[model samples]
Target: MNIVNEIISSLKKIQESNEITVPSIKNKLTFSQIHCIAAIEYIEDANITKLSQELGMTTGAITKMCKKLLNEGYVWKYQKEGNNKEMYYNLTELGLGVCKIHKKVHEKSYNKKKAIISQYNNEEKVTILRFLNDMNSIIEDTFSEVVENYTGSDD
Candidate 1:
């Protein structure tokens, strides 16, 4: 197959496998919501501005998601001392519970894949890893070039 076809086939396989493994996690959480949760987990404590920057979303979009999460009782909001405008958000007990569940689901999926791949001989595994690494490097370079061009950057 040609390179473009090979790339498309690889992406389709990865996406299909992800869907099969993860199932309906996306039904309970939008992509942006998951990203926001991950950012919050990373920062532990963050305000709306920080979340927007970290998630590459607008403040308005983050605010909307935060409102939904708050209304769902997955997150709690509080104002910092002497700064009502500077509100902070963190996962509530329920949110943490959901996070733990998601973590386990991810861990199980990863472990299953790892076990299967571990059955391969050492040299074969190394070859597979190297190919995957090269694919990742190519994708990253292409993405970087696209982003730079879109942003009118010179590099």
Candidate 2:
């Protein structure tokens, strides 16, 4: 297969791999939802805007996901004193547990990748990083254009 096809296939596999159930929650979560939960844990007093920025998602998408999360008992929303208009989120106990699980999952994945990459010398590693960075830049530019030109299409 060509390099582009290989990369696309790898991405599809990664997406499928990321669909996992948090043992504590016992419910399957989408990768994006898990990241949203992680973002909430990472950001202090997370709000819709902050989460959108952190996740590189639109506020509308974030809002919809957050509603599901709130309904699932993972997060709760609150308004700051004298700031009724703006709301913030806090991870529930369940959300914190999910965060811990997510961290462990990531640490394991990182360790596995590190083990694979450790065989590469410094120069090879630098080359790998450079290649990945270039790919990311290209993807980012393409994503920006797609978003800019996007019209309503049923997902």
Candidate 3:
């Protein structure tokens, strides 16, 4: 198989893996909501704008998601002393617990992926990263082209 095809196949396999979930969030939160919790816990004085930017999502979506999170007791909104316009959220005790579970899962995933990279020598590692970067650039260019040339499709 071509190297690019092999890499794409590997990525498809990764996406199909069943071990990509957090038990703490099982049936309680969507993966995006759980990820939002993780981002909120990481960013100091977390606000919708900051969380949305960090997670590559829209503030509108974050606002809606946060509503569920707030209602479900995962987070609570508060003001910074005198500034009510600037809303921030802090994780509730339950939110913190879930965040911890998410963190542990993230660490395990990171370590496993790191172990895979560790098998390669330094030169091979640099070449691998460069190739991936090039692939990403190509995809980005292709996406831009698709958007720029978009027209109504007929099926």
Candidate 4:
């Protein structure tokens, strides 16, 4: 178990944990779609620009996802009074249901991780956090080019 291998293993577990199935959804949602719906619910006055920022996606990509969500009855588009140019998005009942299920899954994951981390002393926790933050910066810098050119087709 080298550090790289350990980090890769942890990422795999995180991915597996995040894979969710919503019973109420007639059409199976992709991970991106599920997160987009959740983001809509989480972000106040959700719009393509805001969603793009929140999801680390391009506005163009967010627009496409929004259209699909709208067609599937998961979300709806609207405009604030006196402002028709900047469209906003919100969850329909169906989207809300999916978001709720997504939230429960996240809560369960959070609690499990919290319990594990709680065993660590404050100094150990700080050290772990600092290490993770550094690793995040390094990974981001290393992958910046790949991420910038990504088409997001895998999602």
lDDT of each: 0.77, 0.89, 0.84, 0.89
True-structure lDDT of candidate 3: 0.84
Kindly list the per-residue Cα lDDT of model 1 for residues 55-144, writing each as its tens digit. 887899999999998887778888878886788898877667666766787799899999999899999999989988988898889988
State which candidate, 1 or 3, has the greater lDDT: 3
Question: Which digits, one per residue and each the tens of the lDDT, describe model 4 over residues 15-110?
Answer: 466445678677778889999999999899999989999999999999999999999999999999999799999999999999888888889989
Badly placed stretches (over 4 Å) of model 3 are 1-6, 15-20, 26-32, 142-155
Task: Give the per-residue lDDT of model 2 (tens digit) for 52-153.
Answer: 998988999999999999999999999999998998998999998888998998999999999999999999999989988887898899887887777534
lDDT of 3 by residue, 1-155 (tens): 99879989996676456344445554456678888888888899999999989988889999998989998888999999888689998999878988888888789989998999999999999998998798679878988788677753431
State the lDDT at 107 in candidate 4.
Answer: 99
CA displacement after TM-score superposition, residue 74 of candidate 1 (Å): 3.7
| Runs with alpha carbons beyond 4 Å of true place in candidate 1 | 1-8, 15-32, 38-43, 48-73, 92-94, 153-155
Model 2 TM-score, all chains together:
0.78
lDDT score for candidate 2 against the true structure: 0.89
What does the lDDT read for residue 15 in candidate 4?
Answer: 49
In order of lDDT, best first, we have 2, 4, 3, 1
- By TM-score, who's the top model here? 2
Which candidate number would show the highest lDDT if scored against the true structure?
2
Per-residue lDDT of 46 in model 4: 97
Superposed model 2: Cα runs more than 4 Å off: 1-8, 151-155
User: Higher TM-score: candidate 1 or 2?
Assistant: 2
